[model samples]
Target chain A: MGPLIPNGIITGDWNFVIAILVGIAFGFILEASGFSSSRNIAGVFYGYNFVVLRVFFTAVIVAMVGLLYFDYFGWINLSQIFILPTFWPAMLLGGVIMGFGFLMGGFCPGTSFTAISIGKIDGLVFTVGLYLGIFIFSESFPLFKGFYNSGNLGHVTLTDVTGINAAWFAFAFVIIALAAFWVTMLIEKKVRKKITEYKF
Target chain B: MNTQTKNNYKPNYINPYLGGVLLGLLVLLTVYITGRGLGASGAVKSTVVTTADAISPTLAKANAYMGKFISGDRSPMYNWLVFESLGIFFGGLLSGIIFRRIRKPWVEHSPKITSKTRLIFALLGGIFFGAGSQFGRGCTSGAALSGSATFALGGVIVMLTIFGTGYAVAWFFRKLWI
Candidate 1:
């Protein structure tokens, strides 16, 4: 009854329109959460602002719980959901590189797009850099082609690896997220008190 | 492009927790409706593949990575992510307008560094991100956020590594932000 597209309730042609609408909602939420500002985003690391952590963790846990509940009610078939394939080595290298990107650029791809929409020059430059970087990667694909395709473990979830029920995992995440929220709240207070130079 | 000395002041954003709830529900809705979660970097990948193909059909087809994405029957740019990304731009614009956050073009960075330095880092960071996403197969929206939400092992791996690396290096780059 769920995943309307795969179930044939919503046709393929509607995917594009749905894509645009979903994207709009995604962009609006990100921007409205102060993600458009690099300073605000960078604050997650600096401890002055934990909005990034708060928003991200909360969103993940909520959705995680929602998925579990949906499956419990038999509203959505868990088997039909897409799971990202685990390519360990490639993802590790990629994650490390992206970490540097986040530190230097202060915006990820999605956030930068929002920043660009609001007339931020930094966002525009970062986006152009994205283009140039991808172009270079495309031209030199042979060098790292092996690395990219290596370590393929297929689409596996945490439950599969840990032998934990999906519901219990969702519950555990909620607890951890809540604990982090408290600790970060305290940290943000202390950090903001110390830092008067940077305005959020 | 709408650069002017506009929007000198804008209101604060919604509460983080509230924003998270809305975002979470949206993610749930998206997956329930489309059978897939949100993505950001995939759109950029499409752009790269489509652009390379358009520029050099022969060369694009010869490349190892880009070659797979190329097909003579259709343009790679016609993918869902591209259209979705276009909508993201429009959605962002709409929010900016409502919040009066749209303003003259400016570089956001720490006062410790010059704007030129900030812009350079931004570009370099973006370059790394582009390469990384191709390697990682997704970015924050696609993997860390959406993937983690579904309990995917890859999602957890990405979310941990990306943030762990962020924490690992945040001290070194303190000048860039703090």
Candidate 2:
């Protein structure tokens, strides 16, 4: 009844149209949320602003709970949805590298696009770097191709790994997210007080 | 009056919780419709493949990584993520216009550092994120956010490691943001 494309409810021709609509919504929400500002994003780490954390965690929990409900109602086939395959070492290396990128650049790929839309020169430069980096990666593919494809644990989820029901995991994540929100609110107050040089 | 003006200077953005809900619902709708989640870096990869393929057909095909995306029938740029990414740019533009955030292009950096220094770091960071996305098979949007929302183990791993590493290294780069 759902996953309209896969189920033949929506044809292939509409795929790109849907993609565009979805992306528009994604970008619009991000910009309106203040994600276009690099400083706002970096504030998460500095404890000056917790907007990133709040938005991110709330989104995660909402999606998680929403998915569970969709599955329960049989509106969407959970099995039909794509789950990112686990590649342990590759993902670990990638995440570590991206962390530094986030701290330094203060914009992820999605966020960077929004920055560029708002006429950010830094965003433009960073995007150029993205092209170069990808080029370098492609040319150097032979060097790490083996490592890239090595740790393939295909399409497993947290429930699959820990044998806990997905509901419990969602519940735990909600609790954790709520707790983090409270803690970060306190931290933001303290941090903002100490730092008057930068305008919030 | 000074404090009031300072408060007024704050960015006029939606509440985080509301933004989160909307974004989350969007994710849900995307999955419900497409049987897949959202992505950002995939479009960049496609562009790279298309450009490399155009520049040197033989060389692009000969390469181990770029070769996989090359096809005889259609351009690599004719991909879903690529089209979606175009939408993201336009959407951002719309929001910027509505919010009046569009301005003459300038570098945004902390007062402690020069714009030159900020741009350099931004490029370096972009390089790392670009390379890492290839290794990670996605960036924050495609991997961490969309991945975790779907409960994928890889998503969880990537999410934890990314934030964990950011916290671990935040102190060293304090001047950049703080």
Candidate 3:
């Protein structure tokens, strides 16, 4: 009944068209939310702005709950949905490296695209660096191929690993998001009072 | 700290909560339609493959990683993520036009640092993020956000580790942002 393309309700021919439309929406939402600005994004860590936290946590919880509801209504078959496979060591190392990237670059891959759209030279440079880095990785694949493919725990979900109902996990996430929103608001206010150079 | 600047100019972005809701719904709709989540880095990967393939088919095909993506039937750039990324650029451009943020290319950074310094850091950061995404199997959108929404264990693990590490190392790089 759902996941239209996967179930044959919609053919593959329309896949590319749909991809464009979805990506447009994704990009528009990101830019409109002030994510196009590196300063705005970095504010989450510095406490001057919590927009990243607010938007990210809200989106996560909303999608989490929405997926559960869709499953409940039998609108979408949960089994048909893609789940990212786990490779613990590799993922951990990747996350650590990306954290440094976020701190130094102040933009993730998606956000950098938006920044570039608005004529940010830094975004443009960052993208070139992305290309160079990927090229390096591809060339060096032989060196780490063994480790890259290691620690495969195929497509397991939190519910499967923790033995908790998905609904409970969703509820917990909502609570955490709400609390973070409140706390960050306070933190932003406090931090804003002390910072003079940046105005948002 | 300057009341004059604060009064004269106000940021015109949408509400964070509203933006979040829209983005989340979009994620749901994407999965409902395509059986996959949103991605950005995949497109870059595709482009890299295509470029390598063009430069030296032999070397590109010889590489363990790039070789897997090369197919005789179509260009690697013909993939879904590539089209989606094109849309992302256009969509971002549309938003920039609407918001009147489009401008001559310039570096954005803290007043304390020179633009040259910022660009250098940006490049280094991009390199790190690009390499990390390959190992992580996805970036924030593909792995962290979209993965967690589906309650995927890998998604949650990557999300936690990413933000956790950011928090841990953020202090050292405070000068870069603040």
Candidate 4:
């Protein structure tokens, strides 16, 4: 019943307008949360600050639970929503590469944009690199076209994989996220105590 | 009350939990309204297609991948993600202004490294990110957050591998951050 745009309840013309509004909320939340700071973001790995882990896990759990509730309440049709298809090899490779990128650049695409908004030169350079890298991929598509398109697992959800209810997965995830938050906090305290130069 | 000044300025960052809740709700709203989640890398993908087309319509048209996005019917830039990405910039700008964080260009890096060194890695990092997003079919925003939220197995897989890999190799890049 919901998912207005997909269902035609909302006109196609409104897509762009909605995009801006949603994006604004996204950007505002990210910047206000201190994601614009590379040091803060990298802190997840260094154990100085665990804001990334805390915020990330919290958000995932909240959204996961919200979606399950929405489905149960008939507010939205879960089947109509888009799911990320499983492209096994490509995804694994991409995630590994992106992990390295996150470490070295100290920012992801979303965070970089926010940093650029505040006049960070490194952010600007990262943007330039994004273009160059993508352009290179596009130009060199022929070399890895087969490999890129090899994996073809269809769109699947955790319920399908585990043969359990979505609610169960949601429940389990909440527990896991909470535990992670707790442990990261301990690590953060210890790391910060040792590094006097680091200031949050 | 004490007057506000640059020297006495305070650093303000909201509680992580609060921020997460807001972000989570926003993600829920997006899926509810659009039947899709938010994305950042996809917007740049569009730019790449448009740029390739601009340089050589024939070449871009001939390339199997680039050609998939280039259409004679509509401009490549007229995309939902492109508009959304623009909003991200403006929204970030708004936040910066409110926080008094808007300032002249500067490089953020560890005290151990030079600005030039940081920039070089930033560029290289972006390049890897760009390639990875394409291969992964989404960036952190699209794949990791929105994907995981949606309960997609692939999203969860990507999220795990990404963070897992980061932790596995973070020790090697200690100087870059720590």
For A1-200, candidate 1 gives per-residue lDDT tens digits of 89899898899889999999998998899899999988899899889989999999999988999998898899999899899999989898888888888998898999999999999999999988888878887788888888888999899998888898888888888999999999999999888998976765
Model 3 Cα displacement at B10 (Å)?
A: 3.3
Q: CA lDDT of each candidate?
A: 0.88, 0.90, 0.90, 0.88
Docking class of 4: medium
Better of 1 and 2 by TM-score: 2
Query: Over the stretch A70-139, how does candidate 4's per-residue lDDT look in tens digits?
Result: 9889999999999999888889998999998888888889888999998999998998888887888888
Over 4 Å off in model 3, which ranges? B1-9
lDDT per residue for candidate 2 within A82-161, as digits (tens), equals 99999989999999998998999998888899999999988888887788788999999999999999989999999998
Can you give the lDDT of residue A141 in candidate 4?
Answer: 87
Give the CAPRI class of candidate 2. medium
Candidate 3 scores a chain A TM-score of: 0.98
Q: Can you write out model 4's per-residue Cα lDDT over B1-178, one digit (the tens) per residue?
A: 8587755555588899999999999999999999999889998899999988998999999997889998889989999899888888888888999987888989978888899989999999899889888888898999999999998887887798888888998998888887
Q: Put down candidate 3 lDDT per residue, B1-178, tens digits, no spaces.
A: 6464423565689999999999899999999998988989899999999999999999999999999999999999999888888888888899999987788988988989999999999999899889888888888889989999889888888788888888999999998888
**Residue lDDT tens for model 1, B20-51:** 99899999999999888989888888888887
Q: State how far residue B31 of model 3 sits from its true place (Å).
A: 0.4
- Pairs in clash, predicted candidate 3: none
> Which of 1 and 3 is ahead in TM-score?
3
What is the lDDT for B31 in model 2? Answer: 90
Interface RMSD of each: 1.2, 1.0, 0.9, 1.1
Q: Cα deviation of A47 in candidate 2 (Å)?
A: 0.5
